[model samples]
Structures are given as structure tokens and as C-alpha cells.
Target chain A: MPEKRQMHLGQQLTRAGRWSRAGITSGPAALWLGIFLALPLAAILAISFLTRGEYGGVELPFTFDSYKRLAGFGELGFDSLYPVVLGRSLALGMATAVLCLAAALPLAFFIARLSEKYKGAALTLVVIPFWTNLLIRTYAWQILFSPNRWLTVAAHSLGIGTAGEALYPGTLAVLTGMVCDFLPFMVLPLYASVEKMDWTLAEAAADLGADRWRVFRHALLPQIWPGLGAGFILVFLPATGQFVIPDLLGGAKTAMLGNVIQQQFASSRDWPFGSAIAAVALLLVLVGLAIFQRKGSKHEVLP
Target chain B: MKINTPLLNRHFCAVVFSAFLFAGAAQAEKSTLNLFIWSEYIDPQIVSAFEKQFDCKVNIDLYEDVDSMLAKIQGGGAGLYDVVVPSDNLVPVMMKQNLLAPLRHENIPNLKNLGEKFVSPAYDSKNRFTVAYQWGTVGLLARKTAGQPLPDSWACIFDPAKSAGSFMLIDSVRDQVGAALKYQGHSVNSIIPSELKAARDLCIAAKSRSVGFDGSVGVKNKILAKTAQVGIVYSGEGVRAMVDDTNTTYIIPKEGSVIWVDNLAVLAKAPHRDLAEKFLNFILDARIGAQLSAYTQFATPNQAARAFIKPLDLENHAIYPLPEVTDRLEFLNDLGFKLRLYDEVWTQIKTR
Candidate 1:
């Protein structure tokens, strides 16, 4: 009987060891993703299939009505309003990401080339704006872009906009806010790649008689491809769902997918519809990431 | 002897004792009453008074719009807040969804102080669900420039030719659409598809020539800052803005406007139902009602409270509209399933 008890104790110790190993490996991550991400996503997916109740709550009996509404079929006939908004949102997001990348590439290189002391200060400057609330910063932009402000006056003098008119509540202001808000996201990641880049390949390209553009295309671009991909994804995904900048700076004259989803949840009180929009947004982001990954893999054979 | 059982037992007893103490402390902390209300709608002094009288904590939470308030209560906040203030138009919606509890009228003897019209409102005809807290009108606020005439009609906003200068449209769906409806000689609460389409078109046309949409407070700020010459705003905001800057004046359009009443109601599954009922009763008291109106600059719906209100405030026509003007105003009713129609129309207007 003592031998049997000793064996049982040994088995319990083994079980405990296995559990501790698993806990060390993937426990916190699994628990976090399970609670915060997976559970909410599952709830949204389920809600997307449900029907809106008489007074805005969800009803149990499943329906595909929300998806149908999102597809532009509504009580007022086949309206393409939602589809138009979605297209506009995608265009705005792509524009913002492209603009950020264009600005960040040079800025990232400049910072990466700085002395260690200056490099820390430069990066700190890039992140300092984040310490202030985004809303307050956006409001500051509104004041600067007002009709009588110096910025608007300068724009008018430069023949960019009509005299005595605000330069905001329009596309220019919205784009400016989006680019300013997302530039850091692109800069930080691109700087990481640039800082680690080797200069020998670029020198070799120049030695091989390649021009400046060719040197960047073949040698420099490949070295920073990973960071570019990371920065692009970071900016593009959040920019796609950006509603606040457009709402505040662009005067809310038009609706984006984000704004529409928000309206469904807040103003319309239709959670099912909001969930459907969110589900579609998630799918679109996943597809985008997949395409990006495929293109990125092709560049992985770089020297 | 090897185990040290007495020492282990003492440690275990201490842990159990502390756990009990924590549980008791948590029970003692239950005196907090959670109140969900509109921002700047209550008097802080009155809240402190209620807290001191009851010897409990009053935790205030604010929401800017009715739909957001409804969303919170529906999305698991029903039991989190003891009391909520919803607009009259939303009372029926809350009632239908069972988000609000039936008020115990006997527990609230101060209900007799309310005006007869508000005592049995159309939204809560039996007075079963909600009690009126304050009432206001949605109207136009125009900056009184040196030479510009004050806008007395909705046409000043809807028609570019009639506008004195750049104006702002209200961002809220009901108020903006209702303004358009009233401009076109339709009821502010009209749910008819054809009428709503016309209103949407009018709003879209107005959007082209105006500074875009904003909340009433935003419009008031714009007017105060001289950024906008005119805008649709709530009467209370207009009155307050007029006080700050004597250059702005509010007018209920000759075509009429929406009269909205915000109500204080207990949640159906409120954790502190008795305390919430007591709060409702306390707020309904004549002096408290007068104080709330004085602080918020909104017209009280309590008849008895009028006796306690300052004569100057009672005489302010902007706060208390004339009977003729009040007759022109219409209250918005719950659209039920037709609400989707308004939502669709609003989306079209915004997109256009």
C-alpha cells in the first residue's frame, strides 16, 4: 500500500510539472486573446446574425437582415449609400497610409542617421504629441484652420483657398489631421529597420554603376521592407476605421463606414447592424494583411 | 510536531478573519447611488444636499444623447445605474424594452407639484414609468450683428437666399430633421416617408451653403466666437449664450419647433431601487425643482416650483415661452418601427 501511495504522488508531481511548463510557454497570451479578443469577436459574429428588436435590443431568432442592409438593400429600395461610404473610407485610409509612408521614409532615415543623443530626442519629439489627448490636439487644429486664423490667411495668400474662408471642415483639414496623427506610427517602425540597415550593399550598388534611384530600389528598399510593411499595416488598419478626425475637421458633411457603424450603435441603437459592419471591417483588414504577407514573402529572398 | 499545525491553523484563521472583514466593508460601501444624467443638466448644490440628507454618496455619470443612454442601459448598464434621465420621446422606447421600472407614485408624494400637462404626459399617459425633470424647445439661435435682422423663421437656415450669413445645422437626427419638417410646413414628428424625403432634401440643400452640423452647445460656441452667424440650438443653450454675449438671440421659428421634456426614471433592475425612488421624490420637491431650473436655466415642469423660482427667471421669455408660441410647438413621439426610416433619411442627408 505504501508503494502504491508513492506512485500516486510521483504521478501528481509529473502532472504539476507539465502544467507549469505549459503555463510558462503560452498561458498569458492564450488567456489574454481568449478574454479580450476572441470572446468579443465571437459575440460580434453572433450578433451580426441576429435581428434588431422592436426597441433596439437584439432578438434571439437569427436573421441575415443586417448583412442584407449592409449590401445596400433597404426599405427605401436598393440604395448604394452604405457601399459608397465604405468605398470612401477605404480610399481615405489608403491615401492616409500612402501619405504617411512618403513623409516617414525620409524622416525615419534622418532620425536613424542622427547621433545617439539626438536620435533619442528626435524620436521623443515624434511621440510627444501622443502625451496630449488626440481630441484636444484635433480641437487645436480647428482653431488654427479657422477662417480668420494665420494659417488660413497664408493659404489664401498662396492662392490655395478662397480669401476669408476657413481652410477646414473640408478634405485638406481631414487629410492633414490623419497624416499628422498616423505619421509617428509609420516613423517608429521604419526607423527601427533603418537603424539596423547595412550600408555596404548600397555602396556595392553604387560601385556597380547603379544610379541613386536604382540603388534605393534594389538594395535599400529590400533592407527596410519589413519595417515598411509593419508601419503600413499599423497606419492603414486604424486609419480605415478613423471617424473622429473626419467628423471634427471635415465638418461631418459625409459619412464613413466608421461613422455609419457608430450611428448604428449610438444613434440608431441597432447593435446587430453595427456588428455586421464591424465583422465586414474585420474581414477586409484580414484580407488586406493576407495580401500584404504574400507580397512580403516574395521579398524575403533578399541578400 | 514536525508539521507545526498550531502555527498553520493560526495563519488560516487570520486569513478567514480578514476575508470576513473585507466582505463586511464591501457591504458597508453599498450606500452609493449611481445617477446617469445629461451633462450640465443638474445643480451640484442640490446633489450635495441630497447626499447630505441621505448620508449616502451620489455618483453622477453623464450622457450627451438619448440613443447613447439607451444603448448603455440595454448593453448591461440597466442594473449598474439606479436612476437615468431620458428625453420624453425615449420614454416609450425605454418602457417597451422594459429598461425602466414602474415608478411607485405613493413613494413620491411630491409628484403633485408637477404641472397637470407633465403629470400625465403623452409618452407616459398613466405616469407609470417616468416623471418630467425639465422641458425645453429646439429653436434657431442667430448672432445679433449690428445690421443683421434676427432670424424668426426656419427658412433663414434652409434657404440660402434668406440666410444673413453662414449658419450651422444641428447634428442631432431628430432636431435637424424636425427643423426641416417644420420649415416645409409639416409636423415636427412626421414619420411619413414622402414628408421625410422632402425634409431630407431641404437639409441636404441647406448643407451645401452652411457651415456643417454640430451639437447645440457647439453651435452656441461658434456663435459666441463669431465663427457662425446663425445655427439651430436648444432654447436653454441659446438663453445661456445670450447671457454670455448680448449679441445672440433665440427664436422658435414661426413654422414651430419640437418641445422636448427630459424625465428622470429608475431603471428596471436597479440595485438601489429604494434610494432611486427617494431621489426622484427629492428632486420633485418645489424648492429643489426651482433650484434645478435656476441652475440649468431650463424651464421647470413643476407648477408649485414656479412660486419659488426667482421673478427675473420666471419673466425670461426664452426660458418660459409665451402660451401662443408654446401652442405652436409639437412634442416628438416614438416612431417605433418607423425609426429606421428616420435613420435612413438622416444617413442620406449626411452623405449627400
Candidate 2:
């Protein structure tokens, strides 16, 4: 009877240990995401299907009208407004991420190649912009691009813009502000990978009669694939949904997806529609991540 | 065996810290009155004075536009704020939604100070649910260069042929869209899809040619900086801008535009209803009303307060437009369900 009782006690302990191991590691994160992330996402998805309330809140009678409206179907007819906006945002996000990648690659390499003593200082310089308020920095850009400022004056002299006019409230300025804001996100991740890269592999490729392009494609790229993908996402998603930089730097001529989402929630009071826009954006991001995980993150040689 | 003790400790700390924060928030101040209104609409001195008189803390929250204000109230913020200042057209809608609590006549004795005309506005007749706070028209704020004629109509912003360079659409949906609607000779609250479509097209075309949309103050800044020649702005901001720099002027526009009365009312589920009424009553006082008007540069509805108001403000044509201009001005009507038309059009204009 003592042996049987001991065996039963051991069995109970074994079962508890299995759960405790998993429960301890993932329990907090699962619970945290379940309540904060997953639940809100579920609620947004639910609300997206519900009808818009008369008072500009959500109500009953579920419909896909929001998604339909998003797909360029409006009461006035099939206008390209939403689709155009989504396309514009996609372009902005893609452009910003590509620009960041172009800017960050060399800078990341430069920082990683810096003597040990200068590495921290260079990294700090990259991150100093983060310390300042984004709004303030954007305003500073506005001032710098003002007619009185040297940059705009120089641009005017160089025949880029009219004399006595600000260089901002335009697309170029928006892109500049976006690049400035997101460059750090791109650089830090890239620098981490670039620093750990085995330079010998690149040298070996070159030594074997491979050109510089081949060396980078075969040796360097495979090493930094994770960082490049991470940085692209880190920049792209936020850039796509970003309203502030576009609002401040770009002329408020056209609303980005973020601005549209804000309008729906605020002035439009169409919470259900807003939720649909948001849910779509979220779904797009998830789809993008999945695609990137499958294809973009894989080590590939340029064929 | 490896242990995750530090990770465990970090998570434990986070839990305790969050719990502490919750406990601290639960012990909020008593006798606190939350006032929700347009930014810079209220005078800080009056707020402080009221706070001292009632031995209570007044928390002020600001909204830039009517829709945002309504959105907040309807989005479970009904029980959060004690008082909210909403525009005239919104009163009927708020009433239908049960967003407002009828004023307790006994609690707000200072309602007597309101002008006869203001006492019973069409939007909130009999002053049942709201008290008139201020009345003003939305108009063009233009920087009149020495050589150029000032922008004198909604056409200045909305019409391509009559375009003033680099104009910004004001952030308020009703006011700016109302301007466009007026320019097209439609009612400011026109629910007709075709008319709204016309207005929407005009706005989008103008937007591409002009500077983007901004708040009234931002528009004023654009005019002042000469980055923009004209912008849509509220009467108060327009008036203030005119004073700050003599080169600028505010006008009611040739086609006429929205004339709105912003009213103060307690939320139906106001957490501090009693205090909200007190705040309303205090606002209605002759001296306080005049002070509020002088600071905001908007027209005061307090009849008794007029004697205390600055004659300079009273005489300003922008504050009180001419009779002929008043003849054409329209008050925005609550379209109820038809508001969706404008909403869709606005979204189109914005996104496009």
C-alpha cells in the first residue's frame, strides 16, 4: 500500500512538473497578450462587422459595408478614394523602408567598422533623435525649410523651389521627415548583424574571382537577412499607418490610412468602419509578416 | 539545472508596480469637476475663481471639433466629464441620444442673465438642456498683402478660379464642409448626395492646390507666416489674428457661412452633476461671461455681461457681422441619419 501510494504521488508530481515548465515560461506572455492584444483585436474584428450607430458609435445589424467601402465602393459610386489612399500609404511605407535600408546599410557598416571606442558614440548619435520629441523635431524641420532658413534659400538658389517659399508642406519633406524618424530603427538592428558578420567569407568570395556584387549577394546578405527583414517591418508598418509626419511635413492635401482611421474614429464617428479599416491594416501587416517570414527571410543568392 | 529567477523577479516587480498604480488611481480626489470644452475657450482665471469659491478641483479637457467631442461622449466618456460645451446643431442630436441632462432651473439661477434672444435657442428651445455660451460665425482669415485684395468669400478657398494661394481647410468638419456647401449655394446641413458631392470635389481640388487642413489656430499661423494666403478659421481665432497683425482680416464671406452658438450642458451621466450645474451657473454670471468673451474674443450671449464687455470687441465687425451678412447665414441642422452622407464625402475628400 505504501509503494502504491508513492507511485501515485510520483505520477501527480510528474504531471505538475510538465505544466509548470510551460506555464512558467509562456504563461505570463500568453495571458498578457490574450487580454491586451488578442482581445482588443477580436473586439475590433467584431465591431467591424457591426452596423454604425446613429450616434456615431457601434450598434447591431452586422454588415460588410465597411470592407466594401474600403474596397472603393461608396454611395456616390465606385470611387478610387480608399483604394488610392491605401496605395499611396503602401507606396510611402515601401519607399520609406527602402530609403531607410539604403541609408542604414552603409551607416550600419560604418558604425560596425568604427574602432571599438567610437562605436558607442556613433550609436548614441544615431539614437539622439529619439530623445527629442517627434513633434518638436518635425516643427524644427518646418522652420529649417522656411523661406528664411538657409536650406530653403539654398534650394531656391539651386532652382529647386520658388524664391521666398518654404521647402516643406510637400511630399519630399514628408519623405525626409519619415526617413529621419525611422532611420534609427533600421540602423540599430542592421548594425547588430553587420558587426557579427564574418568578413572572411566576403573576402573568400572575392578571392575566388567573384565581383563585389557577388560577394555581397553570397556572403554579406545571408548574414544580415534577419536584420534587414526586421528593419523593413520595423519601418514599413509604422510608416504606412503614420499620420503625424505626413500631417506635419506633407501638405494635408491627402489623408494617409492613419489619418483616415483617425477621421473615422473622431469626426466621422463611424467606429465600426474605423475598426474595419484598422482590422484590415492589421491583417495586411500579419500577411506581410507571414510572407516575409517565408520568402524574404530565407537566405537567397541573386540569380 | 538552470533557473529563470531574475526573469521571475522582473515579472513580479511589474505586477506589483501595476497593482500599486491601480490602487493609487482608485483613491482619486473627491469634489472634482471635469469640464470638457474647446481648447482656449475658457479663461483660466474664471476656472481658478470658481475652484476657489466652491472648494473643488476643476479638470479641463479640450476638443478641437464637434465630432470629436461627440465621439468622446458617446464612446463611454458620458460618465467621465461633468460639463461639455457643444455647438448649436449638436444640441438636438445630443438630446435625441440622451447625451445631455436637462438643466436644473433651480440650480442655475444665472440663466436670467442671458439675452432674450439667447434664452431659448431653436436648437435647445426653452434652454431646457443647454445654456448659450457664445455665438460666432466661421469665416476666412486672410493675410491681405499690400497689393492683393483680401479673400472675401467662401469662393476664395473653395473655387479654383477665385483661389487664394496656399489656403488650409480648418479641422472642423462641419464648419469647413459647411463653407464649401455654402459656396455651392446649398444648405450647410444639406443631406442631398449630389450637392455634397459637388462640395467634396471642390474641397479635394482645393486641397491639392493649397496647403493641407489644420486647426483654426494653425490656419491663423499659416496666414501670419505668409506660407498661406488664406485659411478657414473660427471667428475668435480670426479676430485674434487680425489684432495680432494688422495685415490680416476676418470676414463672414459673400456667400454666407455657418453661424454657430456653442452651449454648455451637463452630461446625462456626469459623475459630478451638482458641481457641473454650479460651473454652468458661474459661467453665466455677468462678470464671468464678459471675462470669458474678452479672453476668447467670441460674442457673449449674456445680456447682463454686455455692459462689462469691451466696446472694442463689441464694435468689431468680425465678432458681430452686418445685418445683410446675417440675413444669409445658416445654422447647421442636425441631419440625424443623413449625416452619413457628409461623413462618407468627408472621408472621400480627406483620403483623396
Candidate 3:
């Protein structure tokens, strides 16, 4: 009886140890998320409802005018600028994700196929762009895309643009910058999945009279969906709200959601309006992620 | 091998404890005054010299525009800063908001050193809250290329048919919109709905053909690099660019443009008010004032400092606009709550 009682106490100790261990491991992460993420989110939401002071900055006397303004119900009347800008931002984000995926897939596959000796070097090359500041890289693109530069000269020779004219402050330049900035994000995750791919399954599918496309679709894509989904989210979310890339490369011909929000916080000095726009943008992005996540999980199968 | 978690924890705790002690020691504070002003507006040497003279450390912060500075000050930065440099248009706004502290003339004896024009100016009469730092105009900086003659009229940029090659609009809301309003013979501070809308539409149209909006310095750089032909920029930058690159010329469009006086003022909640007052008086010293203007290439409003200023910089019409130019140029005034009209119109111009 004494032995049995001791064993029961030991099991209870182990139970308590499990709980404490989990707590110890997750405590910092929980604390960090609470402070940086949850606190700011709550503040922004609160600020969104407050009135903008005359000089700029939020004040008391809670108002929904910011939200109303964002919804195109301004003193000037309804205009499609805010809605159109938001739509354009979403479309641009999707385009960036698609472009990143298209570029990363072949690159990742090529790197995965390389022998062990060169694989690390090829992977490092993908990450080299990340070492430099994004702003500097974008500015470099401006120089590269500027007229008389060899790249622009070459592009002109290829009938891409007129001679002696800079190729930038245009959409093509913006897209190039966005893709260059986000390529590593897509490559690493997709490469992780590609490296661990089961090639034998593809061979077996092909041997069972499946075409090359069918074999890839049936065997390989499923194996890589998890990484692809993660990479897509990683690329798309940041691309959606990117201001600097468009500001530098796109020439500010039209404002994106990020630019509009930035103007409010910076020059406009209307923090309430900025917060309202941000809260709505956050909601839109979350909804987008939720939909994408649902679709991705449906396609995901355990390897 | 298994890791020793307890030992690692002990080491981390010890390091963190020491860090807290170091932080506490540092937080005991010093004779430091925080100066918030525009980027590239002040000479670093002037700041260092002030620090040496005062025997106090000066920590500097920079903002690109006045609105951002005002926003920061109002948004809890008031308690963090001692001195701020705001433009003429913002003085009344800051005063009304109670962001500025009353200037103690007794503390700054050099107030008498102000030029006739700067003394008891319209923005803050009797020198109650502000002192003039530097003054300049907003104008066009154009690259004189083979085909692109420099634009003399706002119409050259706004009137698409006579476009002076690819250009960039000034990114500042009031400045850009003001330029557009002036193009249509309207006030830079026009509150008329129709005039404002017309200006907004004009900017929106030009934005596409132009290389988008950029700061004055960026405009100067763009022209210097020959990526663009003309861009709206401030007189100081335009003048500086002219000095460096002869091919670049700064113009005040035939239609009048903005002339501004950037002033030095103390924040209401300044932690080191005495030190700030000292710094203000130090800047007013004739030699130091001249040095500041010469280094920055901005016009000095200090009468006593003019004799010490570099003759080239002092006489340049771009720095101190000619009387004719001054007759045409208007000072941007604080619009109070009505400034929201400009804000809304600016949003439309930027977005549309």
C-alpha cells in the first residue's frame, strides 16, 4: 500500500511538471505577443474612434468621423479613391505572391537538384539580397532602371522601352522591386518542401500511366503544399501593405493603401483617421488570410 | 550532452540584473537638452559648438516636415523635447494648441539682434513665443538640358502642353497645392471650395506625367542626376544645387510662390527650459548666426549676423529674394481648423 501511494504521488508530480514546463516554454512568447501585438492593436482600435486634434494627434470626444471618412462619406461626398486604393493594394499583393511563386518554384527546384557541395552556396546567394537594406536595394533598382545604365540600355535594345528614357517610376519597375525583395521569403520555404519531396512517388505515378503534369499534380504538389501555403502568406501579407517599394519604384502616380495610411500618420497629422484606416486595413488583411488559410488547409495533406 | 538549464538561467539573470543597474545609472540623467528640427536644416558643427559652449550635451532629433514635427510634439513628444524649429505657418497653430512656451526675453538678451522684418512679425507679434531661425522661398529647380529650357511659369508644369520634360511635384501637401492654386491665380491659402478642387484636379493630372512627388532635396538630386528635368523645391536646396551644378537653375515661377520663416521656439513641457533658452541666445550670436546660415545656405534673419555672413550667400537673390520677388511672394499663415480643407484636398490630389 505504501509503495502504491508513493507511485501515485510521483505521477501527480509528473503532471504538475508537465504543466510548469509548458508554461516555462511559452511564457515569454505569450508575454511578447500580449505587449507588442495585443496592446498596440487595442490602442489603434481605440484611437480609431477618437477625434483628431486641430494640430494632429488623437483627442477625446469619441467620434466615428474617421470611419465615415474612410468609407467615402466625407464632407466632399462619396468618392471611389479609398475603396479603389484598397482594391488595388489587394490586387498588387496577389500579383506579388503569384510572381514570387512563379520565380521561386524553378529556382527552388534548381537549388534542390544541385549536389550537396553547391546547395548551401546557392541557398546563400538567394539570401544575399536580404543583407542589404531594402531602401538601398530599391534605390539601386532606380539607378539600374535609369537611362544609359547597361540594364536599361539592354532593355531598350530588346524593344522594352524607348532609348534614352529611364525605365522606372513605372509598374514594371515596382513589380521587379517587389519580387526581388520577397524572393527569399518564398524560396526558403518552398525549398524546404522541395528538398524533402518523395521523388519515388512521382515515378510510381508516372509508371501508372499518369502524364508528366498529372504525376506532378497528383504526387509532388501535395507534398509541397504546406510550405507553399506558408510562403504565399509570408510574401502576400507584407506585399499588401508595402509603401516604400511603391513610393520609390512606382513613382507615386497613384496611392496605395499603405501610402494613404502613411500620409495620415506623417504629413496629414490626423492620427484618428490614420488609426481608422489601419484598423480597417488590418481587418481586411485578416479576412484575406483567413480565406486563404481555409483554402490552403483543405489542399494540405499529411505527408 | 544534456544542457544545464539552471546554470544558464542563473547566468542570464545575472546579466539582466547588471543591465538594469547600468540602465538605472544612465537614467539618473544629465544636463541634456533635446532639440527637434528639420533634417539637414542645421550644421552639425554649430550643434557641437553650442554643446561645447554650454557644457551640456545636446541630443538632436530630425523631421522632414512641420506636420510630422507638430504631430510628434502633440503626441507625447512635448515632454521629451526642449527646443523645436517650426515654420511661420505653424507658429499660430502651436501657440493656439499651447505647445509653445512663452519666450522670456530677459533670458535671451539677443532678441534685439533680430532684423527689422523679423522683429515682432505677424506670426507671433512682440516676440512672445518664437524667434526667427532662417527664411527662404519655395520654387522650381529645373535641369537645363538640350530641349528642356527652364520653366519660368507654374503653367510649364501644370499646363501639360508646355510640360518641361519629366518633373516631380513637391511632396508637401500645402506647398504642392499652394503652387497649383497660384498657377490658377488663386491664393496659396485659398479656402474657396471651387479653387481648391481646381488645384486638386490640376495636381492629380500632373502627377501621372510627372515622376511623382518628392522632397525638395530629392528633387534637386533628381535634376542633378538628369533623371528628371524640373521639380518643385525650396530656395535653399535649389540655390545649393545651382552652386554645385551650373546646369541646374532654381526659379520662382512668374506666378508668386511661398516665402517662409522657420522659427526657433521652446516646447511647453521642456525638461531643460533654461538650457533651451541658453541655446536660443547662443544661436543669436552674430558670428554663430552667420556660420549657421552660411553652412545651411539659408537666409539669416539676424541683422547683426548679416555683416558676418558670406557675401555670396547673403547677396544671392535666391537666398534673400529680390524686393520684386518678395512683393509677389506670400507667407503661408496658420489656417486654424479650416486647415482641414487643405488636408482633405491634399488627400484627393495624392490618391486620385
Candidate 4:
């Protein structure tokens, strides 16, 4: 019994040591999030409730007029932002998520299927594009999509409809740019999960007379669901807040919430309203992140 | 043993903490000058010229446009820059906000070289707070070889079928909205909501047809590339484009465009005020002015440098218009609090 107690004490000490190390590692991260993210976010939330100044800065006194303005929109047979910019942001986010998933899945699978020899080369190809500035890549896309440009030129010969002036800046260019920018974000995370997938389970499922699709659905998918969830989170969150691509590729006529927030701060000089809008965007992001966590954990099909 | 242990740990922590503090203090003592200016406007040669002359480290910061520059400056505690080149219209607003340091004109002997016309602009009447570095008017830049008669109006931007999705306009709030207001025969500084609403509508219409709402520099590139047959650009950039690319031509709109002047000002918290003044005076030299003018191809404000301009290029109405043409133009002043209304309207038009 004494020996057992000693063993138990040793186990407890080992666990404590591990916990202490984790606490140390997380200290810098926590401090960073606390200062850079949490503090600014709290200020933004506080300011959003305040009145907007004439020059668009925040007024000293508090006022709920901004929220009340949104409330007034509810009486007009719609949620203030329904069928407006928010709705468009949501629609664009969903389309971008779908597009990113479709592109990322194949690339992740191909990299995962590599015989452990060419994996580094293939993964490097995926990551190397990200090293270049995203805006520069988006601008390169502009050159490609311009009328009579190389991409459109090839499309013309291939009888693709994107040949002429039809390929100019608009929704299509913005969507394509978003897909290109976020594809790697989805792939890297999915690759980590997919590469670690239990190949034996898939083989066992096939051995049991299951077809490829069934094996993929029942065995492979369960192993990679966490990666899919991570990829979805990675792609969905930033796509919702995308600014540069929409500004550069979408033309001035098509703007997102990011553009609106930027205008509020710079052009409007209305930090309060900008902060309010930012607060709302932050809330939406938090809500999204919460839903993502719940869905990710709840749907884990592990044995 | 336990007491000794805590004491030793505390001593070690204090030593490490002191080391970091000392390092940080040492780093802070180094003198540095941070200059924030429009991208490509500050000639790299000038920066190297100053660095070589002064031996004091100069950090050159470039901003894509004025709004981004203002955003950083107004953010308070950015500590990222010491000197800024803001437009003339911004001078009054910055002065009213106490964001600028009063210039010591005596230290800057080149202040005398600035043409009297630039010295007495409404934004800074005495030119005490800011020194005018470069001045240009908003004008039409068209493709010369494309055979489109020089566009003398902002109407071309609003006319879709012709200039649709192939033209550029200044992305700035004052210039973009102000141009629309001028085109509609309304005062550019009108605070009246109805006139603003009209300007907003016209911009929305114009944006629907525009290839891009870009900076003055980008518009200059568009004109050079011939990707855009016409652009609303700075007169200086327009002149440079016409000179560099034979296909490009510039014309001041008959109705008029927003004439802007960029000024060199010391920030209120400028730590290197003496250095800032030295740099300011260096650019004021007539020979330096001539070099900048030759490269940028803008109208030189220095009388001595005016003779350096080729006669044909000087006669180009787009580069240096006749006196009568200059008479019809107006300078943009601080819009004050009305900037918010313009931004809100611009956002509505852009997002919609």
C-alpha cells in the first residue's frame, strides 16, 4: 500500500509537471491574445454603443441611436441587414467555403496519398504560393482576367464563355481570387489530419466488401472530420472578413463589410460607428467560432 | 532550504528582468527619423541623398494613398512616423486639430523659391505650418493614339457605353465626390444634403461604368498602359505620362477639376524637428526641383527651374495651361466635418 501510494504520488507529480509546461507555453499566447485581441475588441464593443460624431469619430456621451437605427429597420418587414450587405457577406462566405473545400480536398488527398517520398515536394508547392504577398497574387489575377489577357485568351480558344469583355472585374473575379487565396489555408490543415488517417480502417472496410465510396464515407471520413472542421473554420472566418480581394477584384461597386469598416474609420472619421459595426462583425465571428467548436466536438465519430 | 530557494529564484528573476530593461532603454536612445509620404512620390535618390549627407538614419515609410497615411497619423501612439506629406486641403484640418508643428521658415531658406501663388493658398495662408512641395490640378488624361478627342469634362466618366469599365478616377473622398459635384454644377464643398445626394448618385453611376477607383499614381499608370483610354489624374502625373508614353495626352476639364497641392509638414510630436527642416530645405533647391520636375514632369513652382522645361512640353495645355485656363480652376479647401457625410455616401455607393 505504501509502494502504491508512492507510485500514485509520482504519477501526480508527473501530471503536474506536464500541466506546468503547458501553462508556460500558453502564457505568451494568452498574453498576446489578451493585449492585441481581447483589449481592442472590448474597446470596440464599448464604443459601438456610443453615439457617432459629426466627423464620424465617437462622441464623448453615450447614445443607443446606432442600435436604434438598426432596430428601426426591423419594423420595415426585414431584419435591418437582411437582404443587404450582411446577407451578401454570408452568401459569399458560403460559396467561398464550398469552393475552398472542393479544391482543398483533392489536393490534401493527393498529398496524403504520396508514398511518404514526394510528400515534402507536394506540400512545398502548396505552401510556396502563400509566401508571396496575397495582394500581389490577387493583382496578378487581375492581369490574367483582363480582356484579351493570357487566361482569357486560352479560354477563348477553348470556347469558354469568359473570353471577351465578359471577363472584366466583378463577382466572378472576386470569387476566383478568394478561392485562390484561401485554398491553401484549407489544404494545410486538412493535410495534417488526412496524412495521419488510419489506413488500416479503410483497408478493413474494403475487405468487408464495402465499395470505395462506402469505405471513404464510413472509414476515411470519420478519421478526417476534425481536419474538415478545421479547414472549414480556417476558410469561413477570414472569407467573411475578406477586404483586399473584394476591393481589388470586385471593383468599387462591390464592397464587403471590411471595406465599410475601413471607410468608417478613415473617410467617415466616425470611429464610434465603425467600432459599432466592428463590434457586430466581432460578435458574428465569435458566434461562428462557437458554432464551429460545438459542431466539431459534437460530431466526432471516434470509437 | 526553502527560504534560500525562493530568495535565489527572486534574485535570478530580478537579474534577467534588469537585463531586458537595460537593452530596451539602450534601443530607445538611438535617434531615428521616420518619414511617411506617398508611394513613388519621394524619389529614392532624394532619400539616399539625405541619408548620405546627414549620417543620421532616415526611415522612409510609404503609404498607398493619403487616407491610409491619415489613418496611421490619427490613430495616436502609432509612433511610426515623424514627418508626413499631406495635401494642401489637409493642412487646415490638421492645423485646426493641432496635429502639425509650426514650420521654422528661417531654417528652410528654400521657402523663398516657392512661387508666391503657392504661398498664399487658403489652406495655409502664411505657409507657416506646412511647406508646399508639389502642386497639381485634377485633370483628364486620355490616350493620344486612341483618337479620342481630349475629354474636357467629368461627363466621360458618367457616360457608360463609351468609357464603361475602362476608365479610372481618383479614389480620394474629396476628389471623387468633389468632381461629381463640380460636374453637376454644384459647389464642391456644399454641405446641403440634396446636393450631396445628387453627387452620391452621380458617383454611383460613374462607378458602375469605371474600370477602377484608384490613386492618382495608378490612374497615371492606366493612362500609360492604354488599358484605360481616359483617367482623372493629377496634372503632374498626367504630364509625366504624356512625356513618357507618346500615346498618352492630358487636358484640364473645361468645367474644372480639384487642384491639389502636397505639403511637407512636421508632426506635432516630431522628435527630429531640426533634421526634418534640413530635409525640407534640401528639396527646395532649384536644381533639386528641376530634377524632381524632370522625373515627375510636373509644373515646377521654382522660377529658375521653369526655363529647364522644354518649350513644347511647357506649351502642352495639360502640363502648363495658359493664364486664362489657370484662372478658371479652384483649389480644394478643408471640408471639415462634412468629410463624414462624403465617406458615408461613398460607402453606400461603393457597397451598393
Docking class of 3: acceptable
Best by lDDT: 1
Q: How well does candidate 4 score on lDDT at residue A301?
A: 56
Give the winner by DockQ.
Answer: 1
Rank by TM-score, highest first.
1, 2, 3, 4
Clashing pairs in 4: A56-A269, A56-A270, A57-A269, A57-A270
Candidate 3, residue B318: Cα displacement in angstroms equals 1.0
Fraction of the real A/B interface contacts present in each candidate? Answer: 0.76, 0.66, 0.53, 0.53
Per-residue lDDT tens digits for candidate 4, residues A1-303, read 434423443354567766776789898899899999889888887887887644234566787755553332322222343226665776788799999999999889889998878999998998898889998999898788777887888877888654465354678788899999888889998999998888999888999999999998889887888888888888888898788888777665665777777877776666776776667766777897888787767655556
Q: How does each model score on lDDT?
A: 0.90, 0.87, 0.87, 0.75
Tell me the fnat of candidate 4: 0.53
Of 1 and 3, the candidate ranking higher by TM-score? 1
**Docking quality class, candidate 1:** medium
* Residue-wise C-alpha lDDT for candidate 3, range B18-109, written one tens digit per residue: 99998887765447989998999888999889888777798999898887788788777889999999999889888988999999999999
**Alpha-carbon interface RMSD of model 3?**
2.0
What digit string (tens of lDDT, one per residue) describes model 3 on residues A224-279?
A: 88889889989998999997898888776668888888778776677888898889
Model 3 C-alpha lDDT versus the unseen true structure: 0.87
Tens-place lDDT digits, model 1, residues B241-345 = 988988888888999999999999999999899899999999999999999998888999999999999999898888999999999899988776677888888
Q: Isolated chain A: TM-score per model?
A: 0.93, 0.92, 0.92, 0.84
In model 2, what are the clashing residue pairs, if there are any?
A252-B212
